[model samples]
Target: QQYLERLKNKQVVRFASQAPAHPLWPEIERVTLEQLQYARLGVEGGVWQLFAEDGEMKMYKREEEVDGLAVDPLKAVHTVKGVTGREMTHYFFSPDVRFEWETTLEQMKVLETIADDTLVILQIHKRVWPASQRDALFWSHVRRVPNDTDRDAQDIWIACNHSTEHHEAPSNEGKMVRVALTVCLVCQTSIEPPADGGPVTRDHLTCKITYCSVVNPGGWVPTSALRAVYKREYPKFLKRFTQYVKDRCDKQPILF
Candidate 1:
C-alpha cells in the first residue's frame, strides 16, 4: 500500500522528443529488447546450463568475452512462495525497497524518469577485494507481457536494466571503476485452486523468476578477479533477494 500510494502521487518525469540523441539510448533499447526476448524464451534453448542449485533456486552462466574483457552471461531460475509476478516486479523495481535486500549496493539514485515505468539509475557498489569500487548507470524499465503460450495464464512481469551513459554522469572518470551491464528480472505467477474450495491463500501460489545479466567491467581488471567476484556475488545476490521478498510478503497481505 505504501508503494502504491507513493507511485500514485509521484510526478512522472518528462523527456525531450530528441532524447534518442543520447549516446546510450540506442544501446539501451537494443539490450532491453534483446533481454525481453531471452526472458520470454527462458532457459529453453539449452544454451544456459545449471551451474549451481540450492533447493528451488538454480543458477546458470555461460562464459563469453568482449575485446579480451570477460563478459559472462548469467541466468538463474527460482520459485518463491506466496507472491504474484506483479508484486515481485514491483518490489524489485521500486527504489524504496532496493536497499533492504541488495547487500552490495553502496549507493543508488534515480537520474531521470523517462516514463512511469522507466527510469535512468545510477548505482555505486561496494568494492570487492583487490578491485576498485564500481559504479553503474543504467536505464530500468518494467512492464507486463502477455502469455501467448497460455492465453488463460496471468501475464508475465519483467524489469529490465541496461547500462547507459549521460554527460551529467560520465563513467570511468572518477574514483569508481565503471561497469557496463544489462540485467533483466522476469517473474511469472502460478496459482493453484484449492481442492476443497477454501479461500485461496499464499500456499496456493508461487512466483517463478528468471534473472539474466551480463556485466563487463569498464577498465581492464584481471579476469581471474572478475570471475571470482561473480562466482561469489551472483548466487548470494539471488538468495538474499528471494528471501527478502518471502519475508516481506509473509508479513503483509497478499498483493496479487
Candidate 2:
C-alpha cells in the first residue's frame, strides 16, 4: 500500500521476485568468464550496437504500421541486448541524410538507433506537428508518410534541431550558389527577387549564383548585378553558368 501511494506520482519501480523456476537452473550454477564473452559481444554487435555503430543498418523488410508500434524486431531484443522477450522498448534506425528533433522522454524512448552526432538532414511535413508534440501513435504513423519537404527548411531545421551547423552544403559549390538563388520561402533572403538596387525583374535580374563565398561572406551583392549575370551571359559562359546553378540548386526556384 505504501509503495502504491508513492508510485502514484512515479513512472516506474522494481519489485522483488522468487528464484528461477527453470529445471536447468541447478545444472549450470557456475559459468566461466569465457562463456560470458559471447554474451557481451552479442550485445555490442546487437541492436543497440547497430544503433550506436557508424554507417547505415540495412532494412530487409517492414510492415507499414500506424505509429511505429511494431517496427523493432522481436528476435533482436533477447538475442542482442540480453533483454528477455517481454514488452521491451522499440527503436528505429534512420539514415544520416534525414533525421528530426524529438522532445520528451517518451518520444525519445521509442528510438532504438539514433544517437548524437549522427549525420542527419532535416525534412518538414505540414500534416503533423513537431516531434515534440506527437504521441506514440503519431510517431508510428510518421514512418509511413513519404518525407518530401523543401531542402532549405530541412537545412535550417536540422541545424537548429541538432544545435549544430552542417559545414558542407548539398554540393561542393559552397552555400549561397550551392542552392539556387531564389526568394527564400522561409527567410525571404534572396538576391534575384530585387532587394533595393535600381531596376530588378524576373527576366532582367542578375544571376544570384555566387560561386565564391556563401553570398557576401561580409558584404551583400548588389541586386542589379545579381540579376544581370543570368540575363546577359555569353554563349560559352551561359552553358557553364546554367550547369553550375543546375548542379547545386535543390528545388526549382519559386518565381515571384
Candidate 3:
C-alpha cells in the first residue's frame, strides 16, 4: 500500500533535451549494430548454441553469468506468415497495443517520448510464482537499416530496449524487484512476387524475426527458477506477440 502510494504520488520527469544529444546515443547505436550481427550469427549457427525448439521457433542461450546472477543471454529466431518486417516492428514498438498482446505485463507507462523513434517506458510485470513482482525502466529505440548484402532485399527493422535510470523511479529501493535488461527484436521481410502478376497478398510475405534478451534480476533469486521462467516465458511471449500481429494485420490493409 505504501509502495503504491509512493508510486502514485511520484512526479513524472521529462528528459527530452537529454535524449537528442544524449551521451548514450552512441552506445545505443553500437549495441543495435551488435545485436544485428548477433541475430545474423544466430541464423548461421556456430554461435548461440541451441537449447530448445518449439514449432518453427528455435531458442538458444549463451553460457555465462554476471555477478552471481543468471545473465545468460537468449536468442530466438522464427518465421511468421502473413506479415512484413515493417508491420511486425510497428506493432512491437508501439506501446498503445502492447497490453492486448503482452500477457505478463501488469502496467506500463511511457515516461517520456525521447524522439519520434525513441522512448522511455516504465513497466511492471506480473509476478511469476516463487519470484517477486518485477518492474523495469527502459529506453526503447526502433530503426530500419539497409540490407547491403542484397541491395534488392527489403530493409531490416529493429527495436532495442535497454534499462536506464530515472530520478523519480529509483530501483531496488521499492517493494518490487528491479530488473536490468537489454532486449532487441530484429525483423526481415521476405516477399515472393506472384507468377500470375496478381496483387501481392499476406500469403506472399513472411517476417523472419530474431529476439535477444539479457535480463539481470536485481536481488538474488535461484538460478534454476530464473531459467525455468525464461524457458516458459520467452517462447510464449514471442509466439503470442507474432500471432497478435498476424491477426490484427489480417483485419487491416497490409502495412509495408
Identify the candidate with maximal lDDT.
3
What candidate 3 gets wrong by more than 4 Å, as runs, is 1-19, 43-47
Ranking by TM-score: 3, 1, 2
Cα RMSD for candidates in order:
6.0, 27.3, 10.8
Candidate 2 local lDDT, residue 149: 52
lDDT of each: 0.82, 0.21, 0.84
Q: Tens digits of per-residue lDDT for model 3 on 1-256?
A: 9998776566323212245486668877787788788777734546567877888889888867788888888989899989988888888889999998899899999987877778889999998877889999998888788899999999999988999887768885768999998999999999898899999898899889998889889867889888888888888889899999988899578877
lDDT of 1 by residue, 124-235 (tens): 9988877788899988877777788899998888888887776679874779888888899999998898999998898988899999988898777788888887888889
- lDDT score, candidate 3, position 214: 90
Worst ten-residue run, lDDT, model 3?
11-20
- Each candidate structure's TM-score, on Cα atoms with residue i matched to residue i, is 0.85, 0.13, 0.87
lDDT of 2 at 209: 15
lDDT of 1 at 41: 70
Clashes by residue pair, model 1: none
* Model 1 ranges with Cα > 4 A deviation: 1-31, 42-46
lDDT of 2 by residue, 1-256 (tens): 9898888646332321121243322321222122222222333433332211112111111121223222221111111111111101111122221222221112222232122312223222121211111111111100111114543421110111111123322333322211111000010112333356655333332222111101111123333443233223222232332333333332434222
